[model samples]
Target chain A: MTLTSDRVEVAADPRQQYEQAMAERWSDGVPLLPATDDAVEAILAASPYPADHALCVLPPRNGVATVELIAINAAMAGVEPAAFGVVLAALEAMSEPEWNAFGLTTTTSSVFPMLVVNGACRDELGIDYRASCMGGAAGRGSMTIGRAVALCLRNIGGQRAGETTKSVFGQPARFGFCFGEWEERSPWPALSVRRGFRADQNVVTVHGGKGTFPLADIHNDDPRDLLYLIAKSLAFPLANPYLGNPENGEVIVAFNPMWAERFGRAFPDVEDLQRYLRAHACQPIDLWPAANAAMLADRGRVDPEGRVHLFERPDQFVPMVCGGLGSLHAIALPSFGESQMQSKAILSKS
Target chain B: MRTHGVYMRPHQSYDAGMSDPATVWVRRPTAAPGGDESAPAFRLDRAVSGLTIGVREDRAWRSWQLIGDIWSEYLRRDGAETITVETGAQVGQPGSDDRKQIDELAAVVDAAVVGLGTCGSCTTFTIKDAVALEEQERPVVAVVCEEFLVHGQNVATHLGHRDLKILVLPYPLEARPDDELRAIADEYYPRMLELLGVAS
Candidate 1:
């Protein structure tokens, strides 16, 4: 297959090539693999779309992302041919209007796309879902796939920090973050399945997550008490949900396998668990200072009981089981407030 | 020269005598920027007396709300009917309603001043709302803080509205006292009208 992207000659020396990438601002402050024609072609071979297909217009700059361009970036990220589809799926999901990529990409907030994968390919692709899956797992699929998407944003979308994007304090996930759900250990159906995809299909769900908010509980063993505390913690006064409309966004609460089992036993239905979490995910109007309280009241956010609910519906508190078998810790991926989580089924050239 | 799957560390020694050192070819990753085709900007080019004007304010910025209120008062005093709308949500039903309101305001008002682009996304939305009015053939001006002036312009340009009129207010409008905000409102009111092509 013929490649249509602009090609440039570079030094044979690895060190010199790395320096060239850095000098050209092509690297994300990390060494990237050279996107040679052979490498780029290999990635393109795995894509469902043709090399010249304009996939979507990424925002901040509204650059047109073509399959060939995405493949070149994927090659630079060292993404395997088999994993290129994940990157494609992610961009498609983000381009959805409700995803609000235009707003999220340029916001002063620390939000970035966090990819959660579910499907039969998880194990084959080495996507980590257990034991420090979010970080420290060093899975090739997780690292390279996530980095590829970030590179696409930087290169194709033109999302430059402090420039095109005014992100105040970009979080670590900006380097690229992808993880899988432990389907076997989960009490509910896989996140993709819950979202209407089949259990067997590989799906990528993109969340405009602000940052990983950690919650730990060593003293409480009762599921209700633990869930209550988790809900309250998510409703921290400064959360983006409290700052704007309560109807938008979802806060992903990740439970370790052990806690999932306990919580699952208490509320067998995932929707019921979400309802429980939503019921407690609120704070009294008195919790805020007069000014903030007045604003909340003015916006009709304050309830008749003086409680300001974090979200309007149960589904806004999305729950998924992941992480290590070790209990007592859960991670909350806070929302960007305006963006809705979007999912797309991954399509690959079989 | 083309090289594939070559692994040579920086510490490894290379011999010049053994032919030319291997070189590789790679594709440029960045996408090409969009072309510079911008839409036309409208102007009222008439007096404000007996005309209706719209002022769009963001709920997130109280300072802008205060300034918007002051500007509304000024417009009324100048014998112009004023309609003001406060928008907060950027997505969901509220966001849809806000966009609809801006569209309706564009239809009814001869001109509009959309403001409080102090933050990143807010600036984008501010320019977007202004563009909506401009698209409807209504004279409009987008107001942004000093810090987000470039961001607002960039968003406008990307949306193919490069010539969209923008008025830059002082940065960090928040945390300032009401009197200071009022002074700023008074200072920038004339320029806002000027950008909207309001005649002297």
Candidate 2:
């Protein structure tokens, strides 16, 4: 198929091409593969949409993302032909209005899109879901798929560090973070299944995660007690959820396989576990200083018993099973408060 | 080099004694620049008397709330009916409600002042709320801090409301005493009116 994007001539040598990319402000401070015609065409062959179809308009600069443009960036990120569909799905999910791409892209907060995948493709694509799945997994799908999207944001969306995006203390995930759920190890239904996708469909859920907040415990064996601590830990006074409307965002709590098994024995239904966590995820109003207390009281966040709950609903505390088999740890992907997580099923050329 | 799973092939072959260095063709990844056309800006060129005015305040900024309250009092004293709406959320039910309120306020009010763009995302929403008023052909002024003036302008430009009127307040408006904020409110109140095209 004929490509419509503008083509520029660059040096043949990899080292020279790297310099050219740097000079053009196309590199994310890392060397990227050349997006040659062959490379871009390979990625385009895997897309469900035509070359000129506009997938979405990304914010910060409000760039129109067409399938061809996406493929070029994906090729630059070295995305395999088979994995191009994941990148497309992620962009589609983030474009959903509830995801609040406009606000998240321009916020001073350190929030960025964190990709969570589910379904059968996780193993085939090497989307790591266990043993340092959040990082250090060196999984191809996790690494390249995430980077492709990040590159799209930079090149297609025009998301510059201090200029377009006002993110203060931008986190490492800005470089790209993608991981999957260990569906087999989880006692609960797969995240995509719970979100209403089929078990066989490859799905991507994008969360506007500020950063990963780790929670660990080895003392309590009782599921309820350990869950209580996890809930309390999630309700940290300065969390974004506590700063704004409780109905706005969800905090993703990723549990290790061992903890998931134990918790499953205590509460078979995931909804029941979520309800229990929500009930306890609150802080005494007295925890904050006078000024903060006044704000919470003004917002009507303080209940009659003088407690400030993190969120209004139980489902806001989303639980997923992933990470190493070793117990004593869970990770909380805190929300941006103004954005809701969105999920889209990956669609490939049939 | 192998990148994750994709194996990238070399762009071109190099000869042992090539007279000229070989080059390869690649697509430029950046999007085309946006259009220069901007939406029309409205103005009230009349006296404030007998006109209903709106003041949009952010729940996150106490300083802006104090200023908004003072401005509301000033507007009422000048014989204009004032409606004040405080918004905090940018998405979900709260955000939807907030935007609905802005639209409703835009429908009734002759002119409005939308504010508290002291932070990044807030500035974007501040411009957005002001644009809603402008969309109704009503005079509106978006208020932002000195630090975020450019950012507010950029958001306005990107939203195709490049000519939207903006009023700049002092930076670090937070943590200041009420009296200091009151003085600031007193100082910028007339400028806010001017930006709204209020008659002298």
Candidate 3:
């Protein structure tokens, strides 16, 4: 029997009990908060989803997760149950077929799903997209929410090492990497609105980013120059465009509200900027060796012309506006080869 | 494997959330007692006789392209019939939405080699592709850079994959001199074949 979160009793000797359960497998390597039944129940009280509702059947280990199970993870996360429910919604979005967890979990890529929070929830959920928001600082809601998802993936999805599947050096994001778009501070609408979601409703957009790529253009204030610099940065040889078709992957540009507004004013609309980015985010075919070219050509993923745009179809280039008001900095979260950005509304029913 | 299951940080069960302890599942093998009759019976040599090695590209293509050619060369040296090579833009791309290509490839070939081709993030994807082939009950191995080996293995274990294996390469996907590239191929080919459980 366990106490509810409202009634959580400090476990009698929590430390010794934790030690006997399992060995540590994470950095900072602290004992995680137990996702007890009471904790889950408290968390679930904030969400509309049923306690027993199956959220996802994670691959490799195939850990079947229920809404109540997610709440347990959320309880451990230490965020308000309502905030935790938002995390749950994000996970639901990422589990879509296009996100391809079946192929992703077992693959050798270090890339994992990175959740980007946007809209009114940015403040409500307490995501820190201001300065130093990409991965450090250990904020509870910012870091733990991400970690809880990773825990859900590991404990629930069954992604334990050498047991179900294989991947090399799974990223810190595997532990949980999430942040909100600094919409109020941004110059334009949040990435959600750019993707067609309204500004009022809170939404979570899950991107299959292999890793976070920070773009610093201390020199270019000219919108075109800054964008051009960003375009060049996206064309890095190590980027997915080098190996896969641009149409299949994504390049998420996290702009400050100020910059977003400026870009919106400059480009006026999201598609125009996406078109400009899509046109500019190309690389010469010569950058790769003949063998790679042959492989790409064989698939028709690239054109016979040396020029290769990031996307095969114009829509593959995704433009999202987020982050703090401070200008001169942007974040580009690149996609993992075949995954898609999945989205769902934060359920208000609860 | 990144670490033995014994080292699992004592975590509370997902919904249980008891700080007291977790109802952790112990690690056990699935091998039957009949002298391993369930083990795959086909020899590595028999499997790759005319395999069509599919190179599934995610973000980094040069290495995968190189790997495909290397595998083709190695197989030819063993007198196997020509191995047809193919590549894709990977998942999330609209280019090849037939996400089941690994199964299709396994049906068409004796064995397959897919590469996240590089990095910890990308390698996980390659491992997924290899596991897909394994799901079809086909022989496959995922190749990744050395730095990501531990990460890849964790992902493999998390997914409950027993058969998936990773082939390691050095970091920095820049061009190595021809001889160096050859040496890498020479070192990893035998290791990969061994991992595929096909070294005869």
Candidate 4:
């Protein structure tokens, strides 16, 4: 019997509850599951934190995200009770100062929190890491978990377009963007392990990404040549990498399993592949207008030989293996330079 | 359907051991108010005459560039040297190039004016760059649109520089005419100097 006015009174029917919730402006233009008290508590039962425990203060509205409130939103987003820990971890990661949640939520750029799930739960929760993993794949965990986080940002964080947030052309991923890495198919260590987490830890890494940049090739079979083309593609002239936060802003290159295997055969070590990409991910100085070129040159992004490297160092480009068996395509998730990728491990309730 | 328990009604409960479902209450989450911490105030001990001032422009607000150029002229007429640094010509991300320029300007300038903290991320970075200049011991006045005053203040506190000086301009300052921009430069110049602790 909560006394808060936030609670809605509806006929004792799931369909009616959903209708009322939408009329109340809670739905993100999609159908929502009834977040009944019973449903919310069931989701909260899987979390170690108490119901009233405040996890993080979301920005824009500065809402306090208590475990209970998040559980309600999660339940409404259709997240299964067992997968509640991932939602908690994603919120925790976004709350990190380096993630710049305050700025990102209100920016005009079409940036959103891109959740990369890892560890054993990726398989159990059905987080998609195969073809069309970013979207169009019908993974329940991918859909519900991502939507829960987005709803949290909208409802809890108070991010509404044309009102509080001025996000011009907010990307489609803003609705929901969660995917898993194809770690088993990769020749290198998993993304979490590479980032210093244990291989078995259920970790969620959040990146402030604008949108997906797709790449495809059917004729190129040479490994170095394919990688070189991929590197060049990553260095899109107007990409955020050119904004100059090379040290903090990271670009994620998602390679399909087939391409990953082919590239793996050529460069046995991941570091070698990174080095190769760094060498070729550059543009001629003439790519920018003269005035802009002079400015870019001033920052040492443009070398004496008139080549402008996309990033300051090779390590800034993160390579992960994922996507379907199709060998011809790759995707570049560009960073929103002001925010850094933050990762946190999920605390499984034993 | 065959009745299992001696002619049970269609709507009647068959599981006798099941307990009534407990209804849970949904409470709206609390919103945390902005923090009140501010950085120590920085003061300029000299007048604007003969002093080198750095004027920063956020390209998102096209008018800021015109205003910055106008302000530079005004400062030059007043016997002061001015250098302008335009950040984020294309986007809000302050790349290494933008950062290096900020640091270099901080090293050389006696005072600074960072402008166009009208939007969300831009305001955050505006405070960031202004605080960095303050850390360099250069007096700085962060110029923000009136609508984002509280946002700028909040970002300042979050960045651990709550006391960073802020100069609030009109809310919708973008896309104004050149004359209006020049007028803005004139109107805000005295206050900007005052915030920077520069005597007339």
Highest DockQ model number: 1
Question: TM-scores, in order shown?
Answer: 0.96, 0.95, 0.70, 0.78
Question: Pairing residues by index, what is the TM-score of model 2?
Answer: 0.95
> Model 4: which residue pairs collide?
A37-B24, A64-B30, A131-A324, A244-B95, A244-B96, A245-B95, B38-B162, B38-B163, B39-B162, B39-B163
- Tell me the lDDT of model 3 at B92: 48
Query: What's chain A's TM-score in each predicted model?
Result: 0.99, 0.99, 0.87, 0.96
Tens-place lDDT per residue, model 3, B1-200, is 12433333333434556444433332111111111112232224554555455555443456556655776678777656443444453454343543465556767766667775454335555666676666666667777776667766655555456436667777755576766777777877878777666645
Better of 3 and 4 by TM-score: 4
lDDT per residue as tens, model 4, B1-200? 12321111223354678863333334332234334455576888777888999999875567778877887888888889999998872223445578789999999998899987887678777877898898898889999888878777766765567788999998778667778878888998888878989765
Ranking by DockQ: 1, 2, 4, 3
The digit string of per-residue lDDT tens for model 2 on A139-189 reads: 999999999999988888888887778888899999899999999989999
Off by over 4 Å in 4: A1-7, A13-16, B1-26, B29-66, B69-113, B127-142, B145-184, B187-200
DockQ of candidates 1 onward, in order? 0.49, 0.43, 0.15, 0.17
- What is the lDDT ranking, best to worst? 1, 2, 4, 3
Cα lDDT tens digits for candidate 1, A1-350: 99887777777678888987876678899999999988998999888999999999988888899999999999999999999999999999999999999899899999999999999888988889999999899999999999999999999988999988999999999999999999899988999999999999999999999999999999989999999999999999999998899999999999999999999999999999999999999999999999999989988988888899999999999999999977889999999899989999999896
Alpha-carbon shift of residue B111 in model 1 (angstroms): 1.3
lDDT by residue for model 1 (B1-200), tens: 22343333343466877765677878889886553799999987888989999999998999999999999999999999999998988888989999999989988998999987999999989998999998998888999999999888889998999999999999999999999999999999999989989887
Q: Rate the local accuracy (lDDT) of all candidates.
A: 0.91, 0.90, 0.63, 0.81
